[model samples]
Target: MSRASRLLTLLQMLRGKSRPVTAATLASELEVSERTLYRDIAELTALGAPIYGEAGIGYVLRSGLFLPPLMLNADETEAVVLGLRYVDQRGDEELSKAAADAMAKIAAVLAPRPRTHCAIRPCCPARRATASPTTRCRSMCSARRSAFRPRC
Candidate 1:
């Protein structure tokens, strides 16, 4: 794995544990040497990971330390893209525009691989036909204005 990916994995591992984790156990899980694990811990600490420990002892991540912005996984990226697309298709003009803006923000943070995943079209079936003909309702329709009473 790339150094960046490894660092992320290390942070995840540390975050998963409540108690201190020994260096040998961490190295075994990460498939790295004890020395390498120590170096990685040092680097993570320098980068403000809040990892606290010493050699021969164990390391523990302090509670409530938020990590940096994380890259979205393929599934998460796809879900966001699909949800935004649905909103753009079915929502009001202002809501559609908001969805578009949200999509752009998500795209800005994605790497090339996850971006490609996001581009894949989601398989949403077309809306079913209603039993009777329907007229478009106003944004705020009252019982006095229309046959349908607005549910408060």
Candidate 2:
């Protein structure tokens, strides 16, 4: 992965941990040497990430720190939009609302251009060609359907 992606992954991993994580474990998870992990952690610290720890001891992220999106490109954003849309279409009542809520969260974090693209009409990436017969919602709907939502 690119350094930016690696750094983002590191931040995510650290954020997910409730307790301090060892340098060895974090390095292994990142597929980088402990040296590299140290340097990256230093960089993150310089960048104002509230990571605290020593060499032998584990590192921990301070509670309630917020990190911005580093590398969600347009295509990836579109794919996320599509996946959420699919969930909205096929999921039950609670799940569908959850999907909507998740999309709102995504949009809130996204940059202006991609956020607009994901929130508007062009968000859904469903295609008729990729739809499978078994996913049909009802017999009366239609023979052909979009990859996600059932459509006539």
On lDDT, the candidate that comes out on top is: 2
lDDT of 2 by residue, 1-152 (tens): 99999998888777656589999999998999999999999999999999999767799987435546435897677567767876787789999978877775565456656655444442333345555665433421331123323223
Cα lDDT of model 1 overall? 0.66
* Residue ranges of candidate 1 with Cα displaced over 4 Å: 67-152
What clash count goes with each model?
Answer: 0, 0
Rate residue 148 of model 1 by lDDT: 20
Stretches > 4 Å off in candidate 2: 67-152
Each prediction's TM-score versus the true structure: 0.43, 0.45
Model 1 TM-score, all chains together: 0.43
lDDT by residue (tens digit), candidate 1, 19-95: 79999999898999989998999999898888999767799886445533338886577557766776777889999
Note the Cα lDDT for every prediction shown: 0.66, 0.70
Q: What's the alpha carbon RMSD for model 1? A: 14.1
